[model samples]
Target: MKISIFGLGYVGCVSLACLAENGHNVTGVDVVPHKIDLINKGKATIIEKDIDEILLANWEKGNISATSNYKEAVLNTEISIICVGTPSDVNGHLNLNAIYQTAEQIGAALKEKDGFHIAIIRSTVLPGTNEKIGNIIAEHSGKKRNEGFAVVSNPEFLREGSAVKDYYNPPVTVIGTDSDFASQKISEMYEGINAPIKKTNIEIAELIKYVNNSFHALKVSFANEVGNICKKMNIDSHELMDLFCMDTQLNLSPYYLKPGFAFGGSCLPKDLKAFKTMAHDFYLESPVLNSILDSNESQKNQALNLILNKKSKKVGILGLSFKKGTDDLRYSPVVELAESLLGKGFSVSIYDRNVNISKISGTNKAYIDKHIPHLSELISDDLKKVIEDSETIIISHNVPEFKDVNLRFSNKHFIDLVKVKDIVPSANYEGICW
Candidate 1:
């Protein structure tokens, strides 16, 4: 297979060498004459671990070359990977001039070429970039998308120092393209890499890199904040973090990473407030820690707004507790949401088989009594009765009994926070964040 890479920077350099090493004839393309000259001379444009050796070896085998001619590069290669820079401005908006220019150059070059071409966006870009690139190519080359050529959002997840290794050992190779032809070609290109090939929606593939990097940034900031508190208390921060990393069940695993309603339960809300307040008491300013409660409150308000915007007189809460299969209502976010709806003068009904006002005691009983004094009147054990009486139903948990309530009650509007099922947002059903 023949491939052309658009930029000669870190990502492009590593991709060129690694792909060439995998027996693909990889051409390094750039507008800068010096960068192209360096690659053509069997020298890597950027300095990194093992890149110089890999590039030199591949060049000696005649599997790689560099050129400044974008037209020739696109015409000769089957796949053109766009590795251009998407630097941000002062306002944080991406300056996609390089990406767009490369698209135009590839489109114009494809005008004189025959056969199908695949353009892989290896650059980090926002959603809808793939569509824009496809439209640009269609307009410039007088050819239709997914027919004459196709665009794939194959975002690179290569870290700077370990790029060559990262390319070979990524967690997954996500190819976001609608065309089967392009997806197959791009998958074949990465066949030797040790990762599963996940073909996904184009926009999802485009935006996942941003999501990953942003989470990475959040992790660093959170660890630093924890380290600050540990230092203040004379605790071993490194040891604490090492122990924190070992918890695969909750701490270091995918337990609460989904996009859903506000987090509640007895522990998270109470301990987070206590921890951030303790940081304040120690004369330490933890912005990340402080901002968490505000974010949680905002999510609560988001749920409230979704219910109230429906403008229904009667509202039904499918699950009253913070989560499923639990009777603990102390500081439950759903309890807070129900209280807010009642305050807004809406008729509210609560249904939770696990929650029994008779069995409730101590802090749990006290919590519910203060929030909903008339719980016995509104609460019911019968699911059908609660759902049938209400005009708007808010499903809070992902229980099997609640997942298909809309299929049974076709007239009632459902606001799902747990993504109970794949629903088409009609008058009868809607998801909170899906």
Candidate 2:
């Protein structure tokens, strides 16, 4: 397939050389004369591992070339990959001038094109960027989107040191577009690559890079803070981290990664507080560790806001325990939420199959007695009664009994704290975070 890459920067240069190596006729396009001249002379624009060999080999094979002419490049190529830089502005917002400018140039070039063209955004951009690019291209080209052309968000995952290797060996090949033709073409372009091809919505494709980088940054900061505290205690931070990484079930895996309600079980809250307090006692500032509690509180507030926004007098909580199967109510977010609602003068009813208020004893019993003294009055085992009595029902647990409650009580508004699968669609249905 014939492809043209805009912006002969790191991403573009690597993409041009790698795509050419993948048996695609790739043209490197840029505004800078030096970049174009370097590519034309069989030299890589960016200095990276194996890029020189890849560029020279591809250029010598007549499979790669560089040009500043957007019109010619667009006309000659079936697909145009936008690898323009989206640097930060003064306010730290994305400076998308290069991306928009490239879109305009592609749009103008597409004015005279005859066949279907695929404009792939390989740049790291925010959500809605692909939609904006599509609009710009449509406006400039005088053609309708998904008819004359389609804009696909195919973000790059290449690191500077191992760009060429990363190009050929990405974790997955993401093709974010609405058009089937464009998706198929992009998938075919990565046919030889040994990775799963994920075809998804354009916005997800656009936002995934930011999410990945942000999490990576968070991990680094968290590790550094842990290291700082460990050094103070005369412990091997590297060995500790290595052991931490070995626990794939919880630590290194996607156990608690889902977007949902704030964590409020006894262990997480108590342990986190103890961890932060330990750092505080050491006179070490662990902002990342400290921010965890703040972020968790924010999520709880978010859930509270979502429930209160419904403006319902009677609110039913489907689960009262910290978790689904367990009868534990200590530090349960639902318990906190229920207390808040009752305190705010909103009528609240809770149904927990696991929790029997009379059977409660010890600290768990005392905890509820202090937080919600009228626990027995508000709590019930009858799910049907709770559903019928309430205007808004909050599903806090993923119990099998609550799965079809949405379908049963179609009239009641449901605020899902735990994302319940197979929910029957309704105007009343809403996920807390999703």
* Candidate 1: Cα lDDT at 340: 90
lDDT of 1 by residue, 1-434 (tens): 99999999999999999999999999989989999999988999887899999999999999999998999999999999999899998999999999999999999999999989999999999999999999999989988998899999999999998988999999899999999999988889997999999999999999999999999999999999999999999999999999999999998888988788999999998899999999999999999999998999999999898887888889999999989999999888999999998898999998998999899999999999999988989999999999888999999988878766887888999988888655445558887777
Off by over 4 Å in 1: 421-427
Alpha-carbon lDDT, every model: 0.92, 0.92
lDDT of 2 by residue, 1-434 (tens): 99999999999999999889989999999989999999999999999999999899999999999999999999999999999888999999999999999999999999999899999999999998999999999999999999999999998998999998888889998889999999998999997787899999988999999999999999999999999999999999999999999999999898999898889877999999999999999999999999999998999899999988998889999999898899889999889999999999999999999899889999899889989988999888889999999999999998778788888888899999988766665787889888
TM-score of each: 0.98, 0.98
Candidate 2 Cα lDDT to native: 0.92
Mind sharing the TM-score for model 1? 0.98
Candidate 2: stretches off by over 4 Å: none
Q: After superposition, how far is residue 254 of candidate 2 from its true place, in Å?
A: 1.4
Number of backbone clashes in candidate 1: 0
- What are the candidates' C-alpha RMSDs? 1.2, 1.0
